[model samples]
Target: IQMLPMLVVVCLIPTVLSHAIPTGDKQQLQWISKTEALHTLETAVRNDKINCVVCSTIVQGIRQLIEEEQVEEEIDEFLNKACVTLDLAAPYICEALINEYAVEIYFVLERVIFTPDELCGIFVD
Candidate 1:
């Protein structure tokens, strides 16, 4: 009777409100930026609180920097050090770094900022 109509309205309210929620991709993209990504990675490394999902997102965003071949000295330095920071157990996050950096590994190497040892260390061991 009256209770049935109340239950129906409650169910409809949830359906209507669900559309207002942001999707995961939207939230993840909105939360990431280069400087923020770098900070998140740095903090995670320092704190030893590496979350695979967050690290993966940061690494994915970092790929954009590498792809455009951004040549600023600071950008170069960040990538060199950031690459060394991935010591977590998630192979995919490490793989994301490798796949993205593989494209410009030599370019990064030629800069003389990161040694071959450091670059290899990220993936090999």
Candidate 2:
């Protein structure tokens, strides 16, 4: 039946929801939250599934977040309105920042935060 496809997708929703986030590596990217976005990269790298696929995304996200001003504005606004200070705020910001350029923002800010680049070199290293 033509309806079989839609029924299959519908049937899978609960299963998908049950394990919403795939544990190991996929092209999928996790969102960023914390004083700096590097924490996201750190977590991703530590995870068995995320470490490999994440390097390029981390570099790309960091570059994009800083080079693009509009994205920067959006993230700043998100931080303020979303109560980024709260622990619960992580998933919300993570959700909002999924495609946003946060790693780049963190990269750029590192210069401001650390006079000695080596201290923060762990990010790119």
Candidate 3:
């Protein structure tokens, strides 16, 4: 009876090890698009939920989805969608806003090393 438990344990080791080991390629992380980020921001703005906590969460989420090299393009795409979806201003005004602030936005997003919380703290408060 003493060897029976040991035998059972030895028999199960291979089965557990096979399942634990990887058999194929590693999976990649899926990221959201600019449109989704815009939609989320718009919803937060419309619902009066644009506080530091909310902003930090949004920024962190976007940061994870986008790479440093893609910051400028993502900002442009996000702002364009926001202008149309939120209807905050006319097309010219939107264009001007993008022209005026896109570089600053890109600088903050790509060049600055601030964490999402720190970034939102500067802007939100």
lDDT of 2 by residue, 1-125 (tens): 42322211111211211122222244765543332333443344345233323333333333334445434445445433323322223555434542354444454544554322332244333
> lDDT by residue for model 1 over 55-88, one digit each (tens)?
3343333334445555444453443333434333
lDDT of each: 0.37, 0.34, 0.47
Top TM-score model = 3
45: Cα error in model 3, Å: 1.5
What is the C-alpha local distance difference test score of candidate 3? 0.47
Give me the runs in candidate 1 sitting further than 4 Å from their true place.
1-35, 72-74, 80-125
Q: For this target, which candidate reaches the highest lDDT against the unseen true structure?
A: 3
At residue 60, candidate 1 shows an lDDT of 37
Worst 10 residues of 1 by lDDT: 9-18
Give model 1 RMSD, 1 decimal.
Answer: 20.8
Number of the candidate with higher lDDT, 2 or 3:
3
Find the 10 residues in a row with the least total lDDT in model 3.
10-19
Shift in Å, residue 106, candidate 3 = 0.7
Q: CA lDDT of 56 in candidate 1?
A: 37
Worst 10 residues of 2 by lDDT: 9-18
